[model samples]
Target: MRFNKELKNIKIYEAGKPIELVVREFGIDEKDIVKLASNENPYGTSPKVVEAVKLVVDKMSLYPDDSMFELKKGLSNKFKVKSENIIIGAGSDQILEFACRAVLNDNTKVLMNKITFAMYEIYALQQGAKVLKTRCYRHDLDEFYDIYKKASPDIVFICSPNNPTGDALGKEYIYTFLEKVKEPLVIVDGAYMEYAGYKDEKKRVEPKDLIDKFENVLYLGTFSKAYGLGGLRVGYGIANEEIIKNLYKLRPPFNITTLSLKAAVEALKDEDFVNDSVKRNFTQMERYVNFAIQRGFEYIDSYTNFITYIFPKEVSSKELSNRLLQRGIIVRDLTGYGMNALRITIGTKEQNDKFFEKFKEVLNGY
Candidate 1:
């Protein structure tokens, strides 16, 4: 059997290790594992979403509403955009795939920060498109513009509150950059925008405002982050009607499950639950910041649910992460991303306390 040449080089994304996997491997009780790897809402989904899913579980045998009217309507109302400007996907990543498919061809090129979301390059490669990246690890619009002019890429990705290293670009700065680049499709992945918005008002990227200002821009959003619906996998893309229409051409019917649609719609209704969750995230996040400071470790000021702590040359992040894992704690080791760092999701107060205790022992070589 022959595989596509692109498939040979594509590295599979390794998601955070599940608690059950840790239990089986290290003989730890499931209850004893503290998972702070994936940037999931420490508190699970809203009660309303849970109840909504319960009512729809019996309908799993039936296909979901292919039109996705209710969820689109809820998103339209919340974001103040027309329903025609939206397209639902299994997750925001699927919508990203759609965008890549719609614009990219074998000869096409896409630009992104060197260390943004891995999926951006992965999806572009599936279309056989060339990937160009900025020299800096963080989002540098000036560098992006310089490359954009020379390469004339078909798409440019801006992952604000960028993953792994949790810094973000202000919307105003992004808008200025958008003004300069008019032809290419600029994809702004706001997967962690809710947490960024809650942390600082200036970091918020209003989809309605963005799409209204630029026809070529697509804003990707997700319920997986702050809404606590990661398990259900609900995400959407917001853009102009034309962009939405082209993306819909590639969208398969019933891509999202019946329960996911119901849960996302319910998640939208209870803004209080979302807001409270964001508030608690930042509150717990401060402890992680303080821990890093007191330990003389350098860390990024995060706008997302997770914080990245960069270890010095002498300390091995891989060794520390392994030690933590053996103690029934799971945090992301950034060695795969080529950084001597660990990206840890800010968990609940008790969970964080356990991490701090275990992390300290590992740091002290216990």
Candidate 2:
């Protein structure tokens, strides 16, 4: 059978190589692998979340609450938004798919930067729509504003502490952009909000600050990054009642697992766990910064747990990444993002130390 016309052109997303795979392929001990590719909480999940998951394991045969009342209520209380304004997804990425279905079609276009999250383009294109992107490396809202008028896109994506790159969009810039572009639906991907906010709460584009002000803007948040629930795949979106209402229709029944839903509820209660992870990541990122400086490596300024270090022209990113992988360490290769760099997630102190030891040895060889 033939697929939808656009399905053939859509490329599947390439996730980071898993640690289990590394062990299986190279015959290394499972304990020796250091996975710094995905921006996961190396410190692990909250004890509260673990207990919640255990309590719900017996209910796996049962369906999760389709309404997601407790999760939404929890989010509502935390973000200070009404439950009607929040929509849950398997992950924030799934909510993004819902957003594309709500706004994009053959006649519409999605606007974003050339170097933001790749999923924005993937989702837009999958909806059989066009994607218009900005022209620079810097996440400048001014250029986005100029392009918005010309492109007249149906949806706009702004990824803060943007993935793979780690540069955050400033709050003042977001205010200006919202003031200028009031027509299109703007989705701010704040997947790293907790970590970015910890760095300087004043500088980040807070979703709570905007839900009351702009009907056209939607905030995308996830549990995968900071909460250490990447394996469970639960995330959410915040917007006006009308936008949430439209996006909700497209969601499938029993979309989230009971374990994930219950675990996130507990994760929300454990703010101290989130805060400690943020503090540790911040300190480790500074350590990585010093390493880059002392070794003369070009690196991107990061506000999240991951730091993108650009390789010297003399070195190949793929080769360097392969070199690290052989040593039981893994990092994200930036070739897909059109950069000669590696995005390394700042892990726990011991994990970070191992990554650095291998990194130094690899660099010395080059």
The top-ranked prediction according to lDDT is: 1
Q: Ten residues in a row with the worst lDDT in model 1?
A: 357-366
Name every residue pair that clashes in candidate 1.
none
Q: Candidate 2 — which pairs collide?
A: none
Candidate 2, overall lDDT? Answer: 0.89
- Write the residue-wise lDDT of candidate 1 on 1-366 in tens digits: 998887777889889899999999999999999999999899998998888789989999999889989999999999999999999998899999999989998899999998878899899998899999988988999999999999999999999989979999998999999999999999999999998998899999999999989999999999999999888888999999999999999999899999998999899999999999999999998998898889889999999999999988889999989999999999999998889999999999999999999988987774
Candidate 2 per-residue C-alpha lDDT over 1-366 given as tens digits, one digit per residue, 9 for 90 to 100: 978898878878899999999999899898999999988889899998998799889999999998999999999999888899899999999999999998899999988887878889899988899989878865888888888888788998888878879988778778878988889999989999887788987657666888888889999999998899999999999999999999989999988898999988899999999999999889888899999899888998998999998987778999999999999999999988888889999998899889989988998897
User: Which residue runs does candidate 2 get wrong by more than 4 Å?
Assistant: none
Candidate 2 has a TM-score of 0.98
